[model samples]
Target: MRIVSRRAEAVVFGGRGDVTVSPVDLPEIGHTDVLMETRVSVVSTGTEGWILTDRFHWGGSMPYPLVPGYQKAGVVLEVGAGVDGLAPGDRVFMTTSKVCEPVHAFSGGHISLSQEIQSEVLKLPAEVSDLEAANLVVAQVGYNAASRPRIHGGEVAAVFGDGMIGQMAAQALRARGARVVLCGRRQPRLELARRYSADVVVNVAQHEARWALSGIAPGGVQVIVDTTPSPDMSLYLDVLQPRDGQVVLSGFYPGGLDVDADALQKREVALLTNSGWTCERLDATLDLVARGLLRTTPLITHRFSYHEAPEAWSMIRDRDEDVLGVAFDWTTP
Candidate 1:
C-alpha cells in the first residue's frame, strides 16, 4: 500500500515579505528514511526572520521558492528498512537542509539526528517539554558557542543580543560557571535574561556596553558572544580585555562585519565566527537539555499553529518586542 503524506512548508522567493505555505508530498520511506509528522517547529528569529526579508546572504543568489527552516521536532509515523533504534510512534527531533537546496531537491547537510534528536530518535524525556524540544536548535547553537569560548570558572563573559540564540548563549555561559552579563536594547528581554542566570543585564540602548562592562569587570570580559547581526563590530571590540579576551560571532551579519584594526591589535583579542551547530556539539547540547542542565522553556514566548506560519513570520520580521522565540505548534494535524 502507498501512503500520501502532506507536508506544509514556507516558501521564500526573492525580496522581503515573501513567505507562503503550501503542501508537498512526502517521499516513500527509503531504507534509511523515517516518515515523521511534525509536531512543533521553532522559528529561528535571527536566521529565519532574516531569510524571510531576503536580508540573509544578500547580493548572492538563492533559489526561488525556497523552504526556510532548520529546527523541527516531530513524531515518527513510519520507519524505513535498515533503520535501527527508531520505531514508529517515537517522538524525535530532526533537522533538514531541505530548504537550502533547489526548491524540489533535498540537500545532504541535514543533521537533525545528531543535533536535536540526541543521536537517536529516543523518547522525549519526561522533564523536557515539547516547546523546549522545539527550541533545541537554538540551544544547540548556544552550546556550540559556549563550547568554543572554553569558558572557565570565575571568568567574566558578555553576550550581545537578547534573542533566542543570545539568551541561550547566556544560559550556557552561566552553566560553565562564568559570570554572564547580557546586553540588549529591550527591557523585557533583558528582564528575561535575568531569570536565565545572567548575572547582569545591560540595556545598550540607554547606556554604552563598554561603559557597562567597566563596572562589571575592571579587567574586561574574557569572552564576548555576539548574537546581533550588526555590521559595526566596534560596538563590541572596545569591551574586550587587553590580552586574553575572545569574541565569538554567532549572529547572521549579511552585509559583512566592519572592525577597527586597532581595536583587535590593541586588545590582542581573538575573533571567531560560527554559522550553526556541528554534529558533535549538537549531541552535547541535547545531553545538557535532557539532563536538565540547560533550561530553554522560558525562552519560548509565542506559539502559532502551522496555518499561522505566515503571521508568525510577520511577527518575527516586524521585530515584535514581545516575541522572544516563536514556534509552530503542529498538533492540529
Candidate 2:
C-alpha cells in the first residue's frame, strides 16, 4: 500500500512574477526511504534569486511551477522498513527530494521531504546545529569550485564576488591554510568576509585586479574562484600564477561568458568550470562545519519562517547586501 500525505508546504514561483507559500503533498517513502521533518532550509541568493526573477538556468525543469530551494536540515521522523544506519530521531542534513509533485521541486528541501537519499544524506554531528547545516549546499558549492585547483596549505587563493558562494569559498580555502583574498564591490559584504577568516578583503568597485592581487599575494594568486555571474575571467587573468595558475568558475549564468581564448593558451592557465556538487562533497563540507574549522555562523544574517517566505524572498531579492544569508525556519508554521 502507498500512502501520501498532503500536509507539506512549499514556496513556489508562479512564473508570472508572483511568489507564494502553498500546501504541498508530504513526501512518502518506499521500503528503503527515510522521511524528514524539516527544521530549517536556506535560500541560496544566486539560485533562488534567479528562480524568482525567471533568470535561473537549471538544466532540468518540471513543466510545473518552479518551487525554489535546495538546502534543508532536519530530523528524521520515520525510517523505511528496510532502512539501516539511520533512526527516526537522528538529525541530518538533507538536500531536495521529489516528494512534493506538481510543484517541480528542485531538491524538495521545502517540506516533509522523504526518500531513500542514502548516500546524499549525512548524519549531523552533535556539534553542528541544524541552522548551520542548513547552509551546507552553499559550502558545497564553494567546495565544489575550490576543490578543483586543490589549494594545498600555502597557496594564495582569491575568491571573486563577496556573495554567499564567494564568502563560503574564501572560508573553505582558508580552512585549507590558503592565504585567502575576497574581492567584491561592496563594503558590507567585505566586512562579513572578515568573520569567516578572510586574510584580506578588497573592494573591487573601481579597483584594478592587478594592483589588488599583487598587494595581497605579491607573486600572484595561485587559484582564483570566480563566484560572480559576470563572465569576465579575462579581466583578472593577470592575477593568475604565471605558468600554471588555475581558475575555477563556480557561478551560474543565463548565458555564456565573454572570454579571450588566446589569453588562456598564452598564459597556460587551466580553467575548470564547476558543475555543481556531488554527495561526497556535501559530506565533506558538513564535516568541516561540524569540526569548527569552517565557520558558517557569519554567513547567516536573517531568519524567516515558512509563512514568511514571500517576505523572505522579497528581502533577499531587493536587499541584496543587508541580507547576505537567510535561513528558512521550517520548525514552525
Candidate 3:
C-alpha cells in the first residue's frame, strides 16, 4: 500500500519539568512496520517523572522536545507488506516510534498514532484489555525482579516500595508462590498491596522494617527486591539468607548505585539488576495478567482523557493526590 505524509499528536517533554501536547510529523509506514492508533497509554511514574524532571542518569541529559514514554496500547491501523503475523484491526502494544527529526523520540510511546517496527510490537490476548496491557512494560519490571531469584514455593520474599513497580513485584512474587511482605510508607498503597499482592504489609514509617520482617521470616528472606531508586541495599543484610539470599535491583538509580561489596561478599548474596523488557518477558507478563494470576485493574487509582495530558502530568509530577496506575484514554477525545 502506498503511504503519504502524516502527523500525530504527542506528549512532548519540552524541557525539564515542562510538558506540552504538540503535533509531530510521523514517518510513512515502512515494510516490517505497523501503524497503530493509540487507545490508551500509561505512565511509568518513576522513569517518566525522572526523565521529565531531567533526573535520569543513564544517557547524560535527555535532549529536550522529545517524546518520553515506552508504554503504549493501541490498535493496528495498517501493516507493512512483510508483516505476516499482524494485520489491520488487531489490538496491539508497541514501544518506540519513528518521529521526524527536530523533535526526538526518546523511546516514544505517548502519541495519538505511532509507527512501530514489527519486532517491537506484541499482539494482545482477547482476555487482556488495553488498559491492563497499557502498563505491560512496567509490570514486566516487577516480573523480572521476581523471576531473578531462585526460591521455593513457601519461601519468604520482601519487596521494598509500594509504588506501581513495588506492588507489581509483590504480586509477581505471590504468583511464584512466595510469601510476600510489601514495605512502604503510604498506608493506602500498602492496604492495596495487603488486599491484592502481599501476605503482610509493613508501614515502615511507624515500625522498623527489620522488626516487621523478623516476625514473618525468622531465619532470613530468600530474596529481597528493592524497587526504589536510591535504596541502601546493605540495610537488609541481616535479613537475607547467608548463602542463598538474592537481591534484585529493579529501580533506576540515576544518582548512582552504591553496593556494599564486602557485606554482600560475606553472605555470598546474588545481586541482579533488571531494566527494560524483552519480547518473551512481555508475553509471559501478559499471559499472567490474562490468566488472572497477576492483577492489574485493582491497582489503577486514576484515569484521564488524552486531552487532559497536562493535568495528568501535574498530578503525577506534584503528587498532590495519592496516585497509582495513571492512564490516559486516547479514545475518549
Best by TM-score: 3
Q: Model-by-model lDDT, in order?
A: 0.69, 0.78, 0.88
Q: Give the TM-score of candidate 1.
A: 0.87
Weakest ten-residue segment in model 2 by summed lDDT? 57-66
Which digits, one per residue and each the tens of the lDDT, describe model 2 over residues 1-333? 667653667777767457788776655666767777788888887877776666665754434475667778888987777778999889988776654556676656665454446565778899999888988888888877777886668999888888888888888888888888888887887888976748888887868877988877777789888988885776568777777888888998668787787888888888898766688888888888888877786778898888898888777767666778888887674
How well does candidate 2 score on lDDT at residue 332? 75
* lDDT (Cα) of model 3: 0.88
Report the lDDT tens digits of candidate 1 across residue range 1-333. 755433445433334577556544444445666656677777777666665565666435544556566666767776766777878777776766232233532111112221222333445566676677777778988877777776659999998888878888888888889989999898888888888748899998999877889888887778999888773467565667778678898887766778777778787778877766566666677788878778887778888776776777777767777888777776764
Winner on lDDT (2 vs 3)? 3
Which residue pairs clash in candidate 1?
A: 95-112
lDDT of 3 by residue, 1-333 (tens): 476757889999999988888999988788898999999998888889989888886888988889978888989999988998999999999978888888899888889998978988999999899989889998999998899988679989999999999999999999989999998888888888989989999999999988888888888888899998788776678788777589998987777787789888877888988888999999999999999988877888889887788889998877743687888888866
Model 2: pairs clashing at backbone N, Cα or C within 3 Å: 96-107, 96-108, 97-107
51 Cα displacement, candidate 3 (Å): 0.4
Give each model a TM-score: 0.87, 0.93, 0.97
